[model samples]
Target: MLDWSKATKYSGILQLYRNLIELRRNKQKNTRGLMGQNIRVFHTNDQTKVIAYHRWMEGGPGDDVIVVANFSTQSFDSYTIGFPNSGTWELRFNSDWKGYCEDFTNKGYSTTAHEGECDGLPCQGNVGLGPYSLIILSQ
Candidate 1:
């Protein structure tokens, strides 16, 4: 039997779900484009177990979003990933944030993207990534 009273105990999980719901609701228009050719797999490295991609609505600046995922069991420091343009890319979400789970390292990162070239993109940024984590960034 399930304990109904205990359901409210997982505030962290609840918050995470709320945030995800908000993200989906706020980006609803742009998200529809994600299903089509608007999605681009920008980089992938099997050795590092990392992949990066871009999603946008009509492929414009404000609607542009970058996602980086680390599927490895190890953490990475200064992990470089490419960006389509040179500008401020805000770190919108980090799955490894301790706020999401107590076991997380809470090894937060810079809120803005760095300038450089990587994975054939005109701009790049280095980020600290935790194991089995996903990060979302946007300009």
Candidate 2:
């Protein structure tokens, strides 16, 4: 059998767990979705090994959340992604943050969204994506 107490002392898993719990608790807007709202896989780029999607209650703005993920080993400095609206979107969580794990490359991530169009959406933004990482952005 594994010694659970000894394992917790050596791992930062608890911190990550706490962060996730806090996020879940604070994101009231996402509650609708959490309670069987909706999920849409908005974009996918096989060449870049990237995928993006939105989760929301009625699929408008405020409650809307976007999630981007990179599956490739290569990082993208300014990878473009579609936005549901033309407005500011804040980076809520980044899986590559060094706080989660020391070996991760703490890439300078962008916290603001830019206006444009991609993937059939009215707005777009560029983001610094770390290899094999996931990021959540919200208004």
In terms of lDDT, the best-performing candidate is: 1
Model 2 bad stretches (over 4 Å): 1-3, 6-11, 27-36, 59-61
Candidate 1 overall lDDT versus native: 0.73
Flag regions of model 1 displaced more than 4 Å: 1-6, 27-37, 111-116
The ten-residue window of minimal lDDT in model 1 covers 28-37
Clashes of each: 0, 0
Q: lDDT of all predictions, in order shown?
A: 0.73, 0.72
Candidate 1 residues 1-139, lDDT tens each? 8565755787776777676665555554433323335778989999999999988766655577787899999898778788877766666678888997888875447544456777877788777788998877766
Tens digit of per-residue lDDT, candidate 2, span 64-98: 77878999998877888888776677676777778
